[model samples]
Target chain A: MEDQDYSPKSRRRFLRKFGSLGLGTLAVSTGLTESCTNPTKDLESGKKITLLNSKNELVEVDSAYISNLNKDLAPNHNSESRKGLPGKKFVLVVDLAKCKNARKCMDKCQAVHQLRPDQHHLNVLLMKDSEHTAPYYMPKHCQHCDNPPCVKVCPVDATFKRSDGIVLIDNERCIGCRFCIAACPYSARSFNWVEPKDAEKYKDVAYDIEKNVPQKKGTVTKCTFSADCLRDGKLPYCVSACPNGVYYFGNEYEDAVTNGTSGETVSLSELLAQNSAYRLMEDLGTAPSVYYLPPKDRTLIPEIEDTHS
Target chain B: MARLNTIVAILIFACSLGAFSQTTAWEVSADQATKKNPLEILPKNLALGRNIFKRTCVSCHGEKADGKGLIQSTNLIDEKFQKQTDGVVFYKIITGRDKMPPFGAMLKEDEIWSVINYLRVLVDPSAIPPPKNVKLELTTGEEIKSITAIVLSADSAKLPLNEVDVHFYVKREFGLMRIGEMSNYTGADGKVKVVFPEKIVGDSEGNVTLVVKIENNFLYNDIETTAVKKWGTPLLSHEDEFNRRALWGARDKSPVWLLLLANGIIAIVWAVIVYVIYNLFRIKKAGRIFIK
Candidate 1:
């Protein structure tokens, strides 16, 4: 039966019927042909098939040589998600002076990333540079350094830095070694010691490396610079959620950054120079993409509420 | 007992005064309250007022002007609010109390009057006159980085329309960025010229899309025109940085030295294993030959 189907007369009849249906049906017929025969070996069959080429012009090629492209195949999330947005070098500027320990950014980050209450992708820390200096609330996230220490220490290439200056982790590839957690100077990464939040709900969902959703047990997770949101041309979940205008995010190449709360776009270079912006732990030489404006002339002073046991 | 009664009466009187102050009407002098609105209740003024309300007041006044915004404030559509004289409302807006910031400093005098005209229409939609069609022509100046907008009646007469508020905006990635000052009205000749700000970044080719609009005019409503001009600084492309191999890059983009050292170590270890296996086969063969 297979031999009869591949015969010149029957194959030509089949081709003629599919050719009349246009490119749409032609694709289906090609897929059917690919399932039954070796496409490469039968390339010299000399039977012609009409198809639209890349230039949108109709062309004829040997029917046997027509390879079926699995157009329905899911995007290679692991590989493609690792690639950064082209021509974009994302940077985040956190104004320490503006942050009042609202923790709104942390809440939004945790909610979208499906993290537990304790697991924070973004955390607001209260810090005093010196004994006499005033303490300020600092919202810390994955620095997404140009020379990321976490990515360097990953034994399994689970974590990677995209060209756009976003550091993302493929939980599917994470061995839960916690090497990245130790290597990170910022203590940004969180380990899923047990089943992740909503693990059962996301059991069947395909893993998104960009968002790091549908997290698995024994995997490391951290801020992805909101790569998924960036892909949609939106401010990151945390940045848009803040009420205090503490964050400024933009493309480094554009030389401009927009305030999250005010939606004001300003020259990034001028803002850095004017505000005397500095990165966290600059002496560590991580080359962090996240810049911090010193907590000077604070609009809201940090009020520490003691939690009694 | 008489002394205690007098003190108690004084405390009660003070409490009542506090309550009265809370519910008291916003103060507007007699002169301000009786002053008549200077601007006519034209649809154009209403539209302009509505635009200003949305940008400046919507956050607190709510989209419906019902005062259900993030910050609870007085509902402009309420019967009591609508009953106030235009001047009274203008006084309240210009001299805001606790939460409401004074618009007097931010808005022009004419703009404030226009907002009152808009508030009137909000409560009485029937007051809005029918909208007329208009045409907008945009011309870019050659010598200067300026755009000129000409507003005219859409009808065959093509008579230039004066006093129409022409708004200028530049298209941005997130939203439209207003280019010029507010309350930019066409002169008697029905033309408005606005110079573009320098140092605005555009696409790679420095092409900025300029939008000129005559929005919310009582006579002519919602006319707009767009033109692309090479007036902005070209955005610096970071394609080189994106493609450069670095220590933090993805596996495929890892530094050349790192890749070589890592792969070279793996190759050496694997070669040693293969050499040991080959010698084991030779030992087995030698053992068999010795037995023979």
Candidate 2:
């Protein structure tokens, strides 16, 4: 016998509720404004954005279908969010005494930034002075200079200094002229020649400057200091990733620095004073936020012989 | 004289051909064929031989240890194939012909002897006694994590081991996973000491049980001993905020001197250019009147 109880009218009522619920989800996920009436209709007619599906295969989805969930798995920067967190002055100290070129910081920073293979947001350079002098490992990131030359040459004001001691790049606004790259004495900036694999994977997500993700082709990117992680009251990726007690990060206002490798908290001023910290290229008057303690009386011998550029 | 030399060469070539034709069948001399394996045909030797055979000879001779390998022309398990002496087998493996590749250059003589012992086991399991007397005892320092594993014989006398591959494994959900490997010959004391690092401590509580094992050894049984100890501090993964004060932070000054100097130079240059332009205009006007 044919079942007559499952009627079309009830099924239509269930679908109507289900459709509204889906619209509600879409509204919340996209952070869409209240004015976006008929969200589902707009999504149906929206432009398609290519992105990798759960299976890691490229698939075309509506631009509105893009969510932060996919983008937050790994992160990047765009052209907005130039404002710094109020009352925060970020500073980094590299204790050269502890670094053994484990390269954990480099690996972690690269992973979180989703940097291309050729690009390095943080570089660990092997340095040796003379044949008689001992060798040491020096890891360099964006100096985030107070009087950044990169900022001065940026014709469109795409790269700017923040109040919180961070030099950020608005990738979307960059014309890829590479003027800032030339101006930067520290060689801190990296110009994207092509769309990176990470950007291709999360193609649907709208780019965020703070996250420094969904990186665009023909744009510039540098070490963002993981500003989003900082906002979440967390250590920068490089700070936590180091196995050796190399990087020290804290707010200058707090006057305290925490060592990620040893999990030790110490007064910022005391440590810097005792170590005789100095900034790289100080004569240039870039006034860099990062300071370094000279590698002396090292815990272990520098075993790496060759210095890679 | 040339014809005489040619005749001599022809005679020599004929003699060589005759010698080869007369032999016909290749054979090992009775003295060489009767030689026995020098290595003891114990379970340990058999196991080592089996491991080597599985890695190197499994492709040619199938997993079943029979001649039914990928290119099977000979049956090793057959009574007729097994009838050959150990020396004969060893010679054939070293100097191969027809389809088989020569393994003399690839494997050591002792390894080949082990393979022969393994083959013997396949033919008769009961012939070789299992290694029951060899024992391994592992002891570790709770505070320092200095691990010492001693190998002993049946009479409780220490046995010197050479070139042994000892593996230390920690017990995980799915059997044992190897943590570290050490290759060292024991001195006259028969003890191997290793100091585990403070960072690789197993769990949060620092409660770790290590299973020390000797693998692919011929002298002793593949024995394992475990020792629980409080060794090292477990690595804690967390986020920490750090700060440093330098001359880099934003100051209220705004480089007033530099700004004033730059603007002052610009103002002077612009003033001169504007005055020059005005004079040039006036001259042009005067020139027009003069022409009229």
Candidate 3:
């Protein structure tokens, strides 16, 4: 039965049946409501409403079946966002070799989070390990550490690490204390300082813990690893926006990561082993979810002037 | 001071020149431009090339080959692009510039040539050939933890198909995890075997669904088959660790010692305050009695 359901033919049939059933219920409810509101109106008015049927054909249905759905029925994501997705441990692999400071990931991330110009949930830093080492562009996000120091230092339980290997901040509960920011070695967290960008626009918007939008004043905000997108089975904003294919994100439990640019999925263990991938500040024992492949054989050389301090 | 200013002006001009050069036409070496395309412009080859182009190139180069995809790229059917020798186009693809990623590592030499052939057909649709289909049959060998794929022509003759690239993958949450090597083409016998890697985690029941596919093949339409096998080790769930008392755990899951110590200290401080207030009340009552 499970196998049959997975078949394309059966799945399409199931969708057709389900779609009609939903339409029928909607029609009945709207028709009943109309009769209750005004009994004098003729039930057989013969009004027609255009609708795209399940078969992708334009068909006219009785107008009685249609009703305006004014209410936004999106489920409140606040409480559920705290709990992590089960049976999965998300990991991100940043190929430093491929990063050419495209800044597309940063732009998309900042736009979605509604951060100010100076604020950054994800930053591409120019780094030189030593005087002899070549400089490279490193896009750093919240490590979403398994042993997060920020979580430990948070005065309030506002900052937390979910079971799915994501570190999130609940601005609603935050006291505007910057202890987490100070504690974070990666400098991943940022304070709102003043009001967040476009505060008036998001005034009526309910705060989504996953997206961390409707950001409160003075509260700290950091990368949620695009938790909202992950819930919808989509790649993170940064992961999908990278044209350089620098990001490879997937569940560590599956031991696989799919490259954003090339759309190629490879074994996580083998990729790490072969590429000699290393975590940022591994000696700190942060146990970061983000791994980095060295900047060996870089695609584009960094300009000498851009490397100046 | 005058010399310093002159040097800085020269540096600024050099930087602007560097930036301007990037917008110019892509350069192709004379030797690279003269090289010949190895793949023939046959219908089968074009079909295979089209399949690959659709999978890899269509994202950056629009489905119509009009350079209007997710990202702006050179249109394959553009006159300037079409005029380029097949080798020049191949060289550009192999060694990408700017936004275009180098396909050298991802695609095999034959696959790259096939894509170039497909580009020609895009410029002239008359080159597209008739289609062919193939059937894939998968069998698992539990003892050796291996999977064998048999490819055959879809016609009644059931002739075995060879030189078809067979890709093996295990279904994952976000995407498919490729197994074995990238180059797993079938031999003349129309069979290819791949041994599953050791200690791959499956479901709690230790069952994994393996997919065998003849994908992006030039001669045949894409075909695939799947089978469930008890080849993987059972996944060890981390729910216990998540629920366990720790520093990083949720409020309710805080460490027992920390919870006890914090609540214990609060209780002690409050008890002491209450005792002192009670003693003060007693002293006031005694003073009233003496005054009376």
Scored by DockQ, the top model is 3
RMSD of 3: 7.9
Q: Chain A TM-scores, all candidates?
A: 0.76, 0.74, 0.77
lDDT (tens digit, per residue) of candidate 2 on A38-157:
334544545866644333445454555445644333232232246576556788999886676777788887787778667888999888778778888899999988778887777777
Q: Per-residue CA lDDT of candidate 1, range B1-292, in tens?
A: 9999999999999999999888887889999999888898876667678777766676567788899764468898999899899889889888776556567777887789988888878777787657789888988888988999988889999998888888888766544567787668889888999999888888888888888877646556677789999888887767666567766435756788988898999999999999999999999999999999
Alpha-carbon deviation at A35 in model 1, angstroms = 9.1
TM-score of chain B of each: 0.66, 0.44, 0.78
Tens-place lDDT digits, model 1, residues A134-253 = 778889999999888888888888888777889888888899999999999999999999888888776666567888887788899999988877888899998877765689898876
Pick out the ten consecutive residues of candidate 3 chain A with the lowest summed lDDT. Answer: A23-32
**Candidate 2 segments exceeding 4 Å error:** A1-80, A304-309, B1-292
Tens-digit lDDT string for candidate 3 (B214-269): 76554567788989988888767898887788764346768888888888999999
Ten contiguous residues minimizing lDDT sum, candidate 1 chain B: B241-250
User: Which ranges of candidate 3 are over 4 A from the true structure?
Assistant: A1-76, A306-309, B1-20, B24-29, B38-66, B90-96, B99-115, B121-128, B187-189, B248-250, B269-292
The Cα error of candidate 3 at residue B111, in Å, is 6.0
**B126, model 2: CA deviation in Å?**
46
DockQ of each: 0.18, 0.02, 0.29
- List TM-scores for all candidates, in order: 0.66, 0.45, 0.79
What is the per-residue lDDT of model 2 for residues B1-292, given as tens digits with 9 covering 90 to 100? 9999999999999999999876565477787678789999765566669767765676457777787553454677789768899888888887765445467876899889999888877878787555444567777765666787776664645455534446566543213434544254445566777776444434445566777887555455677788776663542322122121222222322355666777899999999999999999999999999999
Stretch of 10 with least lDDT, candidate 2 chain A? A71-80
- The predicted structure with the larger TM-score, 1 or 2, is 1
Tell me which of candidates 1 and 3 scores higher on DockQ. Answer: 3
